[model samples]
Structure formats: structure tokens, C-alpha cells
Target chain A: MKNFVWLLAVSVSLSGCQHPSLAYITNQGDSTVSVIDAAQQTVTHTITVGKAPVGVAVSKELQRIYISNVEGQSISVIDSQTLAVTETLSIQGSPVGVALSPNSQTLYVADWYSDRILAIDTSNTKIQREVIVDKAPAGLVVSPDNKTLYVAARDSNQIVAIDTQSLTIQKRIDVGVHPFGVSLSADGKHLYSVNVYDNSISMIDLKDVEAKTHSIKVGEHPYCAMPNSDNTKLYVSNTQDDTVSVIDLNTRKLISTIKVGMTPEGLDYDARNHQVLVANWGTNDVSVIDARTDKVISTIKTGNQSRAFGQFVMQ
Target chain B: MKKLLTIIALAALSFNAAAHGPSPQKVEKTIVIKAAPAKVWAVVKDFGNMHAWHPAIASTKLEKKGDETFRTLTLKDGGTIYEKLRTADDADMKLRYEIVDGVAPVADYNAFMQVTAGPGAGESTVTWVGRFYRTYKLNPPIPAGQDDETAVKFVTGVYDSGLANMKKVIENSK
Candidate 1:
């Protein structure tokens, strides 16, 4: 009948690509997330989230996406399968950066103004605990084994390591000026911090504690750094330069700079496609980079001010 | 004294002017000029010469410290604004800059001025896109002249006035 045909058309348009690769771009200006189908290179779904969503964390097992809404002061949890917001959990303070444990049991929300990280239990949806950090904690990353959580205390100019079990500070390593984003390798042997003010990246070796951190200069106002699958290369999004600085992890040297859209804020490496998805904040689009050639393959249109600050690609 | 405290607060605001909050507002304005892309880019490429086309900027002072480029703009209405040049890409016909601090009720302002070939023949399009946050950083009881509306209005006004003057200045010239 005519009614059945209309219903079928609506479902097809509403559903996303079933492929494992998709980019959730957090548009703070519009309070929405544009889910880009990486394989098709198009925005398939635009889910409404809380106001001023800045960060994202994806859970592969649970098929969920968590977004930190700074102005809304809450977390918007989206079910990946359905591509819909399942819940909006309120936080006591403003939430900026969000990350999930390797096991997806704990979700860490960084409070930008309050200078603290609150750990929320995903199972029962309880405030499990919290840890106080220094001024302006901007980025969060958990180890592969979920034993350590690293905090980029941006205002303090240092990276603090907290024990995941006890939620206590274990080590505080000083880095260059204004370290905003931190990335850990898959093997958990190396860590990298993006220094927004210094325009460089600090490479820290966890294998050798005595190994002094090496600073590699990058482009202007680099915000996020993401590593490849094998941990051989690192790609950093220079917000002002509209380019990505690709650094060879072995030599600690800048290999090449890949030009992207305006104000590229977040970098996510898609393993299945062997591509890097960059969220362009100024242009409201996502630039797809072919990792092998280091060239922009395609640009998918997103919502206004796309700022997927954390891990946006579903695990 | 209250005066000293106000000065201290202003200094602190300028120092952290590049640090943004979760809520950043953006304004984008574009105008079709009766000129070529090359002619428009030339005026925009001169990072220190903003007063040439902008009617509100009375004069501009250029300075260099170390390897960086900086400029000071004296506004006609009042107050001065300081800016740092991020890049001047001639190949792309683009110029980028950020406001360190200024009279505007904005913080962490970054902008790009791009000149592109037109939607029509023999016409150039100039777009000014700016991203900035309100001067107030903390959770607000919302002070006067420091909210999102004030910051957006100031930038929108600047872009509108400047683009209109730029079209007139470029079209009238040889």
C-alpha cells in the first residue's frame, strides 16, 4: 500500500550504514552530532545532543557514544546501533573532555572550570568517585589495560598519571607550556602530549622512566594528536594552520603536513578504512585523509563548529 | 583601589585571551566585490594595513618581536585591539589572524579572511569568518557586556561594516 512505501522510505533514510567505521562530530554551535559514514563519505545522521557538546567517547562493546555537553553541564549518551540519544545525565560541573576505560566500565568526565575528573559507573549509572587535578584539565586518556589514566592539567603545564584502581595521583610529569591533549600508543609504551601554546608535541616514553621527553615542533595551535594502528605514525591537527602534522614515531621528526579544512580540532584514525578523519571546526565539515598517501580523499559536510575533541570514532 | 583591580583583571583577560571555553560563537560574512581575487587578496595580505579598508580602524601600528608579526589597531570610536598574524597564504588567497586582546567584548578570537573566485563572472567573493568566546569565562550570573550576545554583536558589526567598506574601496581603485 502507499502507507507501507512511505514507512519504508523513512526507515532507510533514518538508518546509518552498518559498516564498523563512522565519525561522530560534535558540533558545539548547533548542539548536535553529525554521524559521518566513513565508507560512503557522507553524513547519514544528525543526532541532537545537549548544548555545547565538546568531547566524545565511544564504547565498542556496549555500542554507545558519550558526549560531554559543557554549557548543558551534562553527558548525552547515544546508542550507536540506533543512532539516537538514549539518555542525558546531569553533572555537577561543566563537562568538557570525556574518555572511557578499556573495559568500558568507567566513564571519565573532565570538569574544565572546577578542575576535577569524575568517574561515572556505566553499569549502575552512579557517581563512582572523583579525583581533583590542577587548573584546567583539558584531555583524558586511559591505558590499554585500564590500569592508568592520564590527565592533561593544561593550566599546570603538566601531565598527571592517576591509578585507575585507587583513583589517586601516581605520577606528575612536567611538560612544555599548555599541554592540552594527550595520546597513548596501543602498546602502552609511549605517550604524546599536544602543547597548544608552544606549538609542539612532547613524546614521553613509559618504557624508560629516565628517558627525557623529546619535543617535536608542529604547526600553529595544534589541538589533538592521534596515533596509527601499529603506533608507527602520529597525526596532529593544527587548528589554525588547517593541516595535520604527521610525525614519524621512530625518528621523532615531522614527516609531512596534510592540508585539511579550516580549524581542524580533532583527529581520529579509522583502522578499518586506513584513513584519518579530522573534525574541521571552522568549516563545519569532516576531512577524510587516506593514510597511505597522506592526502585528503574527501570532505563530508557536518554541523556547525565540528569539535570532536576526544575519541569520536566508534571503537 | 578599584581602578588597580580593574586593570589587573583586564591584564589577566588579555593574557588568557587565546584560551577558549566550551561555548565559542562564530560570525561569517561575505560580500561580492566588483574586482578580481588578486586585487582583493592584496589588500587582505597586508597584515599590518587593516585601516586601509576598514572604516572603523583609524590607524594601524605594526611591530615585530622575535620572528612573529603583531599589529595594533586604534579604533575610531575608542579603545585599541592587538592581534597576531597566524599566516598569510597567498597561494590560497587567505589570511588568518587572532585577537590577543582588545576593546571588543570577546576572548579567544580567531578569524580567516578568504578571497575566492566568484559565483558570477569577473566578480570576487570575500568572506570573513570569526570564532570567539564571551569575555566571561566562569559559570555566569551573566555580567553586563560580557555575555554571548554582546560578543557576537560586536564581531558581527565589525564584519558587516568592514566588508562594505572593502567593496567600495576596491571597486573605486584602479
Candidate 2:
């Protein structure tokens, strides 16, 4: 009977260890990145990164996290297990947004001031190509198909789509004033843009560039948009209004709005826990929401002002 | 002929002493007056008459405390910007003033305007130089973070526009 109890105990322990969700949130106000224990819903550790780290991208396959420093002009690489900066990759003028390829082998950096997109090889940490884009490219995304990259040009009021293979601009579609953040659907058929000045999200049909799609009204200043794991819901961080607007993809309408800290800017979803992590720039905190209910489950304290989050694989 | 030359030399010396004088800073905006320098100087020296020249400033009031010092209030955007003129030299064709605290929406700024004689080879040159710094508060803290260059751009644009307008006013003058 004792032997049977031991086996049952061992099985329970192993099942508990099966799910370990971790995330690294970059806070620009405090110049640090908070290492979060997603399962525990708390900040396990904080790592010091470059000055004003604003953008972060995780390569799950490589078990690395890349944080973009707006003032430092470099990317800090953090090891998932250690939660320490393992390497610093130098980039061009004021790197605002960063993304990893679907294959997790390449990194794309959008330089806001220099008006260029830098493609860096993750293994060598060397720039493979630097493609010039429209004026003030602030937000970037790689299509789910991994064949094209979309960049939002703030000053030009347009989105520049580039062919990933040729590193050439494929098309320039007119967005709204101060187009800052962009995202693509899982099927790679639709593109969503957060127009800062217009305070709305522009849904574009990639197949039909001239299609008159819907413009959903959002907060006072919609800065960035993130799609759910299932690609069914869209979460937008409204900077000026200090709220996050949850949109239902099927209805193409705002389902709910949740109030956050001073200025909520960056957003991403945790597939394992079904929670959304929001980086609030003004208050320097991250709000974790239960995706099942669309309600904030807990508030995790990060750097002085945590701005963005990325995943890091456990080696 | 020598006596006539001596009289002319004396007259020129007196004219030179009358034209040139000393001052701290010069304030000169070249607005085509269709009027003479003395007439324009009459309009420029009295800070109260600035509303007629500067388009951005709706009105101004000059209250003199002493022979050389005066308090000037410029009204714009439903508010008043106060400045103190430390020195006003009509002979030197100069007006010197310093912005008072809480004078404008711009929190940190110090400006000076000078009006000297224009280029005539030997003529004086009216030079205007302003130096000030502006600070910005990120309403929603930057997610990818605060770029100091971004703040610098915001302030630089304001100063640049003001300088451009001042230049336009002076250049369009007759």
C-alpha cells in the first residue's frame, strides 16, 4: 500500500512540472526587464538591459530573448534559464520594435530614426541585410507565411510590406496618421494596424489591397495590437486612454475594454495559461489577464515602466 | 576751403556721435513701414505698438518704471507673457528684454532680440540670436522606451518655427 502511494505522489509531481510558463517583460521607464513566472503569476527576477528597453522578441527554439533599447541603440540577449543578458547586439538608429522569424533563425529590427530595417542572423549576431523603408518606421511584423514583412511608417502614414527573400519593399499601402504598430492573421490573409493619431485599427485584406475594409474605433490613442493564440481575438493597448480594448475577430467589433495603468503600450498572450500580458509604460507594471474570462487576474510589478514582453525557451 | 572742410568735419563728428550709442541687446523686426527709420523707431521703441507688427502676438503693453527700464506684457493664446526691458537705447537703435517667469506655455525658454543698423558696408547689422531649452513629459511612457532625441525634436520644431516667422517679418520689410 505504501509503494502504491509513492507512485501516485510521483505522478502528481511530474504532472505539476510539465507546465512551466516564463516570460521576459521589458520596461523602458526603469531600464530593466522583468522575468515573470507566468504559472505563479509573479515576477521571479528582473534583468538590467540597455537604456530604455522598449521592444522584446523571444526565440523559443533558441531559448533566447532579445530586448531592443531605444536609447542604447542595441539589442540585449537574455538566456532563458539564467535570466541574464548573455550578449548585446549593436543596431542602427533608435531601434523601437523587434521581431524573430517564424523559423527563429533571423531577427528583424525597425530603426525609427534612421528609416531602415535591419535583418540580423540570430546564430552569428551579425546583420545580414539592411533594407531602407518609409519615413519613421516604428512597428514591424513578419507575415505568418514568413514570405513578407510589414512595417508601419509613422511620419509617412503608410505601411510598407517587404518581400522577405529579396529584402525589397513589395508594396506601400496608405494607413492613417502615425501608424505605429501592426500584426498579421494566422492564415496570413489579413493585416491589422494601430493608427496612433486616428485612434483606430485598420483591417486590411492582404489579397485585395484596394478593398474597403473596416476601421474599428478604439481608445484615445491605440498604439499596438496583438492576436490571440487561436487568432480569434485582438487585444489593443491604448496609450493615452490607459486601457486595453479586446476585439472579437469573428464579429470585427470591440467586445470589452479593461482599464490598466497610466499608459499601456505593449501586449502579448501566453498560450499555456490562456492569459494576456500587458506592459504599462506609465505605471511600470504588467497586468496578466485570464483569457477565458477577459479579466485581469493579477498585476505583476516589473521595471520602473515595463513596456514589452517576449518568450524564452527553457533549455 | 580749409575752414569749410573743418566745419564739415565737426558736423560729421556730431552726426557720428548722434547716430551711434551703447545698449545691452537690440530688438529689430523689419516690417515695411513706407515710413522712415525715425518713424519706425518710434513704433518699435514703444513696446506697446508691437501688436501692429508681430502677427503671432495679439497685443503688448509697455509700462515704464524708469527712463531705461520697462515691463512689457505680450498677450497670445488667451494668456499673457511678461518680459522686462532692462535697457532701451534709441540712439543705438537697440531694445533689450528678458522673458519673465511663466511668460509662455513653453516652460523653459529665454529669448533676446536686437535691432542694429542693416548692412551698408560700413553700416551696422541687426543681429538676432535666441537660445533656450524645452522639456517634454512622455504622456504614456514609451513602450520601446523614451528617446531623448524624440524630446529634442519636439522642442526644436517650436523654436525653429518662431525663428522662421521672425525672419519672414524682417525680410518682408521695405
Best by lDDT: 1
Poorest stretch of ten by lDDT in candidate 2 chain B: B14-23
Q: Pick the candidate with the highest DockQ.
A: 1
The second chain of candidate 1 has a TM-score of 0.88
Assign candidate 1 its CAPRI class.
acceptable
lDDT of 2 by residue, A67-153 (tens): 898767789998876777899987656777788888987799887667889998888876578899977777788887789989898
Residue-wise C-alpha lDDT for candidate 1, range A1-315, written one tens digit per residue: 899999998776565344458889999889999998787888989999998899999997788999999988899999998988888899877798899999999999989878899989998676569999988888999999899999998888899999999999999988878888898998887889999889999999976655768999999989999999998899999987889999999988999999899889988999878999999988899999999898999999899899999998873
Best by TM-score: 1
- lDDT per residue for candidate 1 within B1-174, as digits (tens), equals 233223223433443633456577889999999898898899988988999998778799998989899999987655688999888889989988889876667788899999999978889999999988887777545677677877787788788888999999999999
What overall lDDT goes with each candidate model?
0.87, 0.67
TM-scores, all candidates, are 0.90, 0.63
Classified by CAPRI criteria, candidate 2 counts as incorrect
DockQ of 1: 0.33
